[model samples]
Target: MMSVCGYRWYPEYTVEEQYRDFNQRQYICTVRVFPDYPGAEKPIHWSYGLGVTVDMAVQDAAYSMLTIMRARHALLQNSELCYVPASQSGEEGYISGVYFDSSMEDPLLQSTVEMLENRDRDARALRMELYATRARLWTALTQLAPVVQTGYGEMEMLNPVRTHLPAHVDWPAIGGVTPLRGPLLPPVRGPRPHPCPYGSQGS
Candidate 1:
């Protein structure tokens, strides 16, 4: 099998005899597959089998290894090589004479799609929060405009008294004078401040 696949090296095997029940003995065979060159540093795959005879045990181990290679698309089937689609491979998805493990492709694609969806959701939430904050700030500023203008007018009206009164005088301690409180009064003149700049203008 290794020669057919263009590998110059062959599989290595180890066998051991084990005692079984009833004074019987069994053979245990282990096979290790290495890369094509001699003295390869590591074995690519390994399998073990047990049988009454050494030959049977070795054959069993070889069969197990072949099964694994077939599933990985490493072995030729019916004298024809299988091709994997590009979508499944996630890159060049299709190879004319090569096979790959198609099982892992779907999960990789699903994870990528899920990550994009999560990012989109987070961006939309941030935009909504920003819009809400701007709306609340505009509302507060608009509601406070009239009170600010009324206070400014009152200060202007009191300017004369402020200039004539002695510097030692404490207005809050004098008669018929009290601190401004309660609901704010309306502006004495002119139109109200304009609505929020972002809102539509209408007559």
Candidate 2:
């Protein structure tokens, strides 16, 4: 039996808007040729794009994508020859994709993979580490004690408390602090004017 797969493929795309480390792009310039395999093959057509920032690479999420593409290859090849749109835009973490077929042989496919890899590397590098993440986790488990739980329970290191309120008040965790009162300004005195009602001329 012929199997089918639906995935987003970005053919020719342009960046309509861009922001820090991300770009919102649009692409719809390819026509898919689905002459054969229409009836026997379950024709499914859909596309999606993804972005993964560098620091968020916990549990080797990067590998998951490679695996997905690798798996989707067979299904992609069986579908009608089609063009899909794929795009990615976001701060720091961003991944983009284009409509693609089942093989990694396409030049565009190779380039797209390279681009994704580069973005991943940039993100990983910007955050400055892989092991540092592990180390941080290690520290959380082995070192710091929770401020609240003085008992022997495990703890994680947390950032110091930040305050925007008056220094005189106690800063408790989670609860909001009362804002300090400021001096009120006196109301401006304006001249009182007599209003002429009804007639324009005063008799």
Candidate 3:
């Protein structure tokens, strides 16, 4: 019922700094999803908006995360149903609606301008035509349901645009804010020191 989407900002390689597209500064935003969860079959990762500020990038990522959460919540609410991985499916299909209705003839019965001025036979005919048109439209909408799409189509709607990172990007060094040449790795964490039984190390 929760989304695993996480966000990060790279201000050094911003669109404004690299491309000089605009005067205002922007950020290179990245989102990583489904990496650590055991429930997920595979990870979904993507990024967006080199032109957007850091705050805006976070907002966009949050919106996508919420959408995933909603889908998960719906599945949890209905335990009888199972969720399909739209990205992994290969089927292509669409739904069709009803083709014919006698009500289509009503358009042929429209009244002329002369009938409107005279308040004559054509006026009564126009009223009948209008009524039939409304009825037909209502019937079609109420009777027909949208077709269920294939997994690919569902995946298209669900997933965000995939990220394509540029080559030869620089990364910041540990404890330093400045960018250095080459690809960056995740920060390494040192092991926690054992607590002393007596007191300070000096003692």
Candidate 4:
């Protein structure tokens, strides 16, 4: 059986210039759970972030996760978010671990911490929290362990705050390197050429 959830985060996606035409969009990214016969609506969608302040991005991330609950994990509706959003530059990160062992009385439990420290598939950081077990949430949260893919990266247990990005020695046009205002409409491709502002053809 497969399960999935939707999450969102405003990564510190730096730009050479924060352009004038930069319009805020309502993002409705979708995800899926295999072996689950959910239709299109199964994926999450929300507009609360359209033109919303940066402060609301974390709430939007939670909403995105809830849209998944409305489809898959109905029990999580009562569960508070383990983490909220934090900001550094253009990157908005999530606040996890505060409630990590919140559900464990002997908070120093080894197995639980090991789970938190371990890496999920693709080596993405994993946010492990021992959510309080309830009749409603018992079966659900456990099953959710393997399936939740997070956009707000996990706290690296060793050095959680180490800042780095995709190692780029000299990759052209990487990490918002493009001139921000270059084009509003996407480029058209064909045998014939389109003219640029200098009266020269082709980009």
TM-score of each: 0.35, 0.24, 0.25, 0.22
The better-scoring model by TM-score among 1 and 3 is: 1
**Model 4 per-residue lDDT tens digits across residues 119-143:** 2211122211211222224345334
Q: lDDT tens string, model 2, 144-170?
A: 434325755432223222224564653
Q: How accurate locally is residue 29 in candidate 4, as Cα lDDT from 0 to 100?
A: 20
lDDT per residue for candidate 1 within 1-203, as digits (tens), equals 55545553567777677632222345677878787876776887677755545655676566556544544544554333322111111233211122334445467565554554455445335534654654565565445556656774342321122123454652222122223533323332555333221233343
Alpha carbon lDDT at 105, candidate 2: 53
Candidate 1 Cα misplacement greater than 4 A, ranges: 4-9, 74-203
By lDDT, rank the candidates, best first: 1, 2, 3, 4
TM-score of 4: 0.22
lDDT of 4 at 7: 36
Give, for candidate 3, the lowest lDDT window spanning 10 residues: 81-90
Which has the greatest TM-score? 1
Candidate 2 segments whose C-alpha is farther than 4 A from its true place: 1-69, 77-113, 120-141, 144-203
What is the TM-score ranking, best to worst?
1, 3, 2, 4
Model 1's number of clashes is 3
Candidate 1 overall lDDT versus native: 0.48
Highest lDDT model number: 1
Q: Which pairs of residues collide in candidate 3?
A: none
